[model samples]
Target: MAKHDLDPNYLDPNYEPVVNRSGNHPFHEVLAARLQRRSVMKGTVGAALASLMGVTLVGCSSDDDDDAADSADSSGGSASAATELGFKAIPVSTANQVVVPEGYSAVPFLPWGTPITGAYPEFQADASNTGAEQEQQVGMHHDGLHFFPIDQKAGGNSSTEGLLVMNHEYINQDALHPNGATAAADNLGVRPEDEVRKEIAAHGVSVVHIKQDSNGTWDLVFGSPFNRRITGGTEMDIRGPLRGYCKLVTRFSPSATETRGTLNNCSMGPTPWGTYLAAEENWHGYFANSEVNPPREQTRHGVGSSSRYDWELAAGGADAYVRFDVTPGLGDPDTDYRNEANTYGYMVEIDPFTPEAKPQKRTALGRFGHEGVIFAPAVEGKPVVCYSGDDSRFEYIYKFVSSQPYSAATAGGYLLDEGTLYVARFNDDGTGEWLSLSLEDDDFAAKVTAANGSMVGDINFTGFADQADVLLNTRLAADIAGATPMDRPEWGAVDPNTGEVYFTLTNNSQRTEGQTDAANPIAENRTGHIIRWSEAGGDHAATSFDWDIFVFAGEQGTETVVDGEAVVTLDDDNIFNSPDGLWFDYNGRLWIQTDGSDAAPYQNNMMLAANPVTREIKRFFVGPVGCEVTGVVTTPDVKTMFVNIQHPEVDWPFGTEGDHPRDATVIVTRDDGGVVGA
Candidate 1:
């Protein structure tokens, strides 16, 4: 068969496709090999610099001490984090319940399928909750979340009572169904319509009002007006540049200004204006693109013949199910649901305070596979800057700075609609450049004026009809601009004190020999690392910056080299791999979470706290079996921490009442009533 004929995305009907959703890295290695060929010469200068950096970072001792290496690295890293952690590290565990340090306490709360509204319904012992029941109950797989104090004024951070907003990434089918899933045509894999609907309703975001009891323990307010669920079937608005794009026109909204629901909501970001940014990751798997002439954009994003859940095969052939089949029919695009897929893959904005408001997809942020959106410290009179990672093997990191300067009196979604979007290209020399994706940028227009590739003909990419086209087809624009691809960029956070941006590049097994980049120094990086950068001249709006490999994740005592220079040496207390969720506390300490597949000693996923300046990393918490430790936040006082433990097996949080354990949101606080992580 011809090479093109064998392409699963195009010709193959029997294609058994897989996109590596199991926190693996093999796909990244393969993509690195291909990109290395295209950008090999580009790394020539980077090799030498990486060698020098290896000497500076790789040979450090893993003594887990306070004084020895602290002074050595403090001079170069963040001064605010120069002090070491005050507590001893927790030992690794294989238990089926949450574990924490001796001085701290962890309590599981708000498990999935719990009710907080008038539509209250119990998650039965048989796990037979209907689609309607799941619709109003808390969704499954609680991920990232935030606490908004009910009494805190606008633009203020709350430390007392408030609403807890969170993301529900996906569902656990076995735990959500009775007797497991039963396809009507058992062998054919056709799921019951009601079962499929229930799953859809369980995938999205949840906002519930939470308050601290008189005893200082947190409890959910069962019937607060703020308690709401924005699920995959809820109505939403298609805002920003793509609002009226021709490609977004569909039978549901030919005007391209509206759509339905948000799915695959993962790692979240809370806006300074009190709203929440729920990122859509791996959303392509929820959609099945059936167009005969599948656009390269759709295929590259992983929208194909089949989906992970096969929602399209729901028995009733309802519009909700049929819409997932994005195959263009013989009729016009507006006559069918062909463009419904285009309406998704965005950073959705939701207002927890306003329960009546529909979520809005901010298209100007540029869509691919958004893990989350985090903002830098906002300076009065300065424009707001936000960063996002396109969570996939060989995807790119993106930045968006509002066009207008900050106005606390006027800051809102308007700032997002008018901005410049740029993609990161990390150089080997510890420095990087931000390539513009905006059509209005002179440099970007010049680079694509005559660009030609396998996807586009010998036409000028700058000739796109409008800015909406650039934003809607953002992934393509980033590729055309020569942005560097990364190994599954996930969640990101900014250091409040130094304004340094940190992103988690999860494991990438696709990287073959000699395909390693300085930021990703190891071959077949099953264990990931953290990459951080400071904008040029320390200006958040700058287009260039300096960067470095903050730390390499692996088993204790493991050593990694970059360009032949010995870099990171892991130790018992600091050893961790597949660093996934990341956020810096107000104290300048970075909290690292993982979703790893490491061996027994490192079997359970964990969370650690690091003093970057002192080079101190201490494991703080370890999760239960078959669970993901993700999404974390704290009250303004930093007295209590909120975290999400997703999809734990053998049931947790809700006890052994049901057939399976329930995923939950946990509250961690100091036993002495002191600030957490102090």
Candidate 2:
């Protein structure tokens, strides 16, 4: 199978999203004039305007290298007062267990396959869990998560006891199946139905009530009414524009207003009104279309010809596993699962406090492989703006600005339904614009590009007549809007003090030397970088803003320099790469987590803390081998922290080498019980 078949997002993100980079494209001259630049991309850094449209022709350069090097050495921590951090920075490690600063401690909790409620089934220690047993247990490969304070303390948001809600991005069957998975099930030439069932049950989100006692220790409260599991088979409501699209009609819900299950939930966000935004990334992996002519949408998103685990092969039995087959069979629309894939790829919201409430797919946020959603600080009557990233290479960054001013009394999900979705076009010259994807306001001119990618002329591509049309095909809408594609955008973090949005552009190995943008200045960008932007006039609803490279993540010895000066030098205090997950603690400290290669220069993935204002990054915690250092949440008091380790290659936290190492959340707290980072 082609690499794009495994994951469509793996393709080059540096590919110019607009058609004609060769300068001969018809839209080049006309559309260039149509793009109303809010600013001339003028900045002290250089003539960044040349690379603003992702194909800047000018040779832009910066001369702050010597000034930055004179400011701080890589061996030192941030130029800011990062030394005030409660603990010393820990070195990278490839150990079988998690590593924290000397003054901090890590306690593992809620490992996958562990029963959260119901009959209280023991995690089939012998790897003998049935499909039903797995359902009652915690899902696998934990990713983005949050802690909802159930009963809280006065004058604050921190709660000693709360509901812990998290997303299980994908399953790690090696630790799930007794002997692991195999594709060669010759029983009628299909994958074993039982194996497929176990995997399906292991995907989705988990909610459990947890308590931190007077001793500052934390543990799960099993059998609590609030403790529940949301699997890929769980029913969900398809809300907003994409809900009623004719293309979304499936056998499961002929009304096209509902869908079954949420899978590949990667990163997430906590709504101001207290709902969980569990984003579905890599959702296209679950579907396998066997149709001779797959829908263009499916083809664009990389829905495969066969299931990732061949779940479609069990079609002879029941529809339990049949939904994975999105192919348009001979059956009528009311009896086939053809449009099932359309139902996913949106942000699914769950109310942890109300376990009985149905999970909602907020389509107004638009769709793609949503790495996550991050809302700017809320103002009661101000328009609420939420930002999200399309996780594939060359995918655009997006935002949903509510059309109605936010009301504390209004529900978060409904506010999402009536909003304007916009795609970002970042100019190299510090300034960026948000292109409207709304049909009434969107730009539909498509600079025609041949199959070979040469620009032909300014041609009209896809057009929309309503909000649904614009949102249902969000990627196409952004493409028509001429949004600049980025390098695998992952999680985003908003500065509590400034409301600036920072997103991690996870490394893209596909970006070759020939493919380079001013912002994405590196080839094969093995070490990803963080990009930060401030909304115009401090308004999230604004269409344009200023942006710059916050910091280039790399190893200690690697000196990233430009214009006769050192841009960034990674050293012992902060040597990391591939920034993926990002969040801000109450004190205005930004925490960065990595999902980089786990090898020599990098023994393991790590989580780092940075002074966003000072651009100082400090290594805080490192995870066990084979695990991605992802998902983090801190108590308002900053006393207790929750960080997740996913898909560990070693049986860490559980025991020594032989024990089954399941992905789990680990609680980090100052041993002295002082405020974290105090």
Candidate 3:
């Protein structure tokens, strides 16, 4: 792939600046305000600096005064006793029951069938949940969440009273309704309107207020003022170079000023400015189409596949289901829903604090099967940086650094106005470069622009109009710009202590024996691995970076067996496979979550906590059968951690009575647990 030359003109001088809040409020005030009711004791300055930089840094303190208090504890006492917070594992059985350790318990902060809006009838287990009704109810399959403290004055880790934002990745049709999805019936040629509505409602995200009692049990405040559900039906603004672009125009919002809600919101991120970044993944399978009358710009955008679902053929399908087809039809681009596909894919930002605020689809981040977005710590007058991964075989990883410095004052609104988007190109020599994807660069244009002055060539540029268009169609832009293909890149995080960016390249089965190369050294990478790269000189905005494999997924010891026989083994560590969700806790502990492929000896999906610098990892907890451990977050105080357990053993012969399926969030904390990863 040819490297694109940087275009200085693409740099927007008039870009909005990031707001910084560090100086406006005292350090303690900022921490207290952000943490809310969470009890926060003063830690060493090193810990504060590490958290501020967005890197994982750990510090242990010894105080003789606490020894007397420690001896009275049930777990026994010693200097090392301070580090051992007795955490009990809760087993949430298929009965929709939440199990936890002896001293701890679990409750539904928000369940799967709660109502959200629009007079939707109460969710019925036996009756069909219409698409519209589904849209008005709580979405299914909750995953990856964070608790934002509602009260600015609340202190300590128990400041559990806050807004809980969770991702509703996708719905299980068989378990969602009394009967399976109407769209799945053999007699059902196309998806019904109700089914489409239900599917749409199941996408995107949910935010609700939650509080814990004096006993440390958590519960949701139903219909709280801050409780908001953002689904496929929500109104969202298109921001960045693609805003108002013709390619995005649709009949619903002819001007392209706004569009419907986000879809497939998987793992997510929380902004320093108090908003949530929900990622859209596995979006390609929603629409259905025929080659004969393909959308006018279908080929242009690389969505030439026949509809993945035949929703367009059902009653009221054209209006709801057909929009996903993306084939251009009669009527002006602004007057038809053909361009609806162009609206999705970007990272949608929502203010959990403001229920009525319009969600913004940040085109600057570039579009793909986004797994999650994580930020690097922001310094005064320094760029705010974030990293993302495209969760697909042979896709790519991306990073975005805001062009403007962050300020707490201006950070509240539209802080994502402008930024530099770069794609990672892992080299054979364990080095990587952040390839610029900005539209202003000549090299980018030369590669992206058609020879005849069209936005796309015979290859179909996907009918993009400008830079915003390019951003919305980021995958295509990256392809045209020659970004390196990767193996199923997933979640990523920037170490607040060391400034290193870590991402998961979850297995790529397409790689064959002879196709092995130094950059992607392993072929048939079933077990996957974690890759870490450091920006040049620890600078987030730098174009070049160094890279290395932090840990290879598989079992530990000599010739480890995968299933019944030995497939691969790790001499250094004993671990599980398919690393998925990842996050760095407040104390700089790297939490790694796993998914899929339970090799025979392996019991179940699990989560791990690691010391990144030492590359030492230990299994923290495992999930029940047929569940993936994903979307992990720790409260500001780090005493509590939340890990999402999604779709436990979803298979065939679905039923709602005895065989009904349930997905919920699990809160993990030590029985006598102090700060997590301590």
Candidate 2 residue runs with Cα over 4 Å from true position = 1-84, 152-156, 182-184, 442-466, 516-522, 560-563, 656-659
Candidate 1 segments exceeding 4 Å error? 1-55, 58-74, 77-83, 154-157, 187-190, 453-463, 514-522, 560-568, 657-659
> Please, what are the lDDT tens digits per residue for candidate 3 over residues 1-678?
000112221111111111111111111222222221222112111011111112221111111234224322311222233233234322222332333445643333345666655563576656466666766666777777877878642333345778778888876665665655554345445555666667677777888777777787877675677777788778889887678787778888877878877877778888877778998776554544445645423432335444333445556555655677665567788656666877777788888878898999987787777888888877778888888887876567888888788886666435566888887766544456787787677766666655224433244334446666567656656655556666578888877777888888777666575754322334465667677778899888888887655655654332311122322223222346778888877666788887757544345777766655534345566666677777877677776777777776642122344334666667766667566555
Q: What C-alpha lDDT values do all the predictions have?
A: 0.74, 0.72, 0.61
User: lDDT (0-100) at residue 234 of candidate 3?
Assistant: 84
Prediction RMSDs, each to the true structure = 6.1, 6.8, 13.0
Please identify model 3 stretches exceeding 4 Å from their true place.
1-109, 115-133, 152-158, 184-190, 292-309, 442-465, 517-523, 558-573, 650-656
Best by TM-score: 1
**Total clashing residue pairs per candidate?**
16, 9, 50
Query: Which candidate number has the best lDDT?
Result: 1
Candidate 1 per-residue C-alpha lDDT over 1-678 given as tens digits, one digit per residue, 9 for 90 to 100: 211223333211112133322222332333233222222112111111122223244323325446445435633653453234767788888887788989999998888888877678876767778999988888988898888878654545667689899999887666777755554346355678888898898899989998888799888887789899899988889888898888988887888898888988888788767789999877777777755657654765778776666677888678778788788878988887778888888999999989999899999998778899999877789999999998877678999999888877777777888889999887655567898997778878866675533333222233456778778777777767777777778989887767889899876766676766533455566777777888999998899998776766766545534444334455567667788999887777789999877355577899998766655678889998878899898888888999899878776656555555688988999999987886
The local lDDT score (0 to 100) that residue 442 gets in candidate 2 is 20
Candidate 2 structure quality by residue, lDDT tens digits, 230-306: 99889999998777788789887888988888988889999988889999887777788977767656665767686
- How far residue 516's Cα lies from its native spot in candidate 2, in Å, is 4.9
| Residue 610 lDDT in candidate 1 | 77
